[model samples]
Target: MSGRPVVEVIDPGIQSTVQAWPGRTGLLAQGYFPSGPMDHLCFRASNVLVGNPPGAPALEIDKIAMSVAFLEDTQIALAGPEGIHARLNDVPVPIWETVRVRPGDVLRTANPGRPGYRLYLAVRGGLDVFEALGSAATSLITGIGGVEGRSLLRGDVLSALPRDPVSARRFPEALRPRFTTEWELEILAGPRSAPDFLTDQDWSELVSLPWRVDLNSDRVGTRLHPHRFRWANGGSIVTGGHPSNVLDDAYPVGGLLANGDVLTILGMDGNTSGGFAVIATVPHCALWKVGQVRPGRDTIRFRAVTYDEATALNRQVDFTIDPGRVQVL
Candidate 1:
């Protein structure tokens, strides 16, 4: 087998895209959204396992079922919730650890055995893709970065950066995230809520029940069922017809847009600004769970927290993954 450095996409499976650390930044005010990997925890873990610096560009596969042919020998790794079925040259491959791929070898991933939605694969030197807006992440909505800004399709080919050989490694089992159907996200009170836009009763109901994910969800955002909320003013003073509409303003990373009984959480590829009222915001640390939730199967609950607490959680998550060293960013 030749040691040439190329990968051929045999099948794109689902919404497979190239993602990197911190994605697109410093452009949200200009109507640009960061289109990086949905699950940062898994994405970073995969990169570290393959000897790439944390936040290195990698493949973020949605719903599994992708196939590729390696034209060169290299080291790779996969990281995500348990239950993914992956194989190299028809032999089963383990997740969370680095493995060697020989030239002309076929690598394929089947249905994920668990409930999560996104999975990550990282090569030793990171995938070679054009960087747009200082990132290689693909935004399906804007079509801006990473492989012409879309998911991988049949016949797609990717190049790997040249690097000195590195020893294979695995992340500690205790540090890996466990996948589950139920999720509890810690949220902070939104800017609009400070003026009492929502009543006390509304907040109680929001956290009291588990909400199912709608099938119509996408990279831009996902809708939750049974919104069960109204303006505190009892439907008076309509905010531009729909109860959710408000003056357009810059949106946060995880804006909770509400329109009467319907609610949608802004995701990594969400719009920069909108007319919807943001009822609450999910901190950066909890966003990984939002990306891994499966539509029509997963459910979510939000618990309110202070901004300080949210920031602390972010640091905690980072320390849990890579404690003793600074990220290369």
Candidate 2:
């Protein structure tokens, strides 16, 4: 029905954008936000199912209820916090596994209002979109990559890069990350977790309690409620008015940043540097949990972990996402 193998957007869902693996890198120092997939495990698994190499461009959706039409034969897969409902040509299909489609085939996705969060869609070949700063990640912060650097809109067309098809596959059930509202994140001390600002007891309370997710949370930063820290300096700095204030510090992607009385979990599109103090940094392995969590409804508690332990956990996650571990269909 078309010339090049293409997918046409029928209804672009909210916050839906094209993303890729290992997003913009080595350039954050020069002011680029590394806007990649929110859920790395789900993103990676989708690519593997479709036989795409790492860095292949894929679609990311939040509260997905979108529709797209295929113009040719290709393979596709979906993955995320919880597999949402999808149908191909009005026939039910499943997530976390490869599905075949041909010309005139339409794929529609929607949530049942239960547990799904961020969802990813991958084609046999990655989507054909422009690259910015050597990446295809669409950073809404700067609007520099992917479909003119913005979330997808209806009538947008994406052609698949030239690639051969691969066999069908799915992620292993036992190895899948458990998506939940109450997230227990493993964190390590940050640069400003010292006694000069926050006391030892403050650090203890930060890790020991469940923090409420704030409605203000977004891709820039996830906000948390009730900043109940007993500051050693009485919320005062040499030139600051708030207890969490400190000199501008280089931002960490998963850092726990204090902004006034509200705490934030710095995200992919968050600030590169700021005046807030970062008391903890969530490890890469656990950051996916942050990406899938529901703001204004969910809660999170911190669990302190050493650097060595974090590294081990990352390795374990890597091993679990392997294609060999999932079912062969």
lDDT by residue for model 1 over 164-242, one digit each (tens)? Answer: 7676676776777778899988888886664467777778877777889998887788789966565675433545765
Sliding window of 10 residues with minimal summed lDDT for model 1:
320-329
**Candidate 1 local Cα displacement, residue 195, angstroms:** 5.2
Please report how far candidate 1 places residue 292 from its true position, in Å: 0.5
TM-score leader? 2
lDDT of 2 by residue, 219-267 (tens): 8888999676787876555748887887776888889998877889988
What stretches of model 1 exceed 4 Å from their correct place? 1-4, 234-238, 323-329
Candidate 1's error at 113, in angstroms?
4.3
lDDT of 1: 0.81
Q: Choose the strongest candidate by lDDT.
A: 2
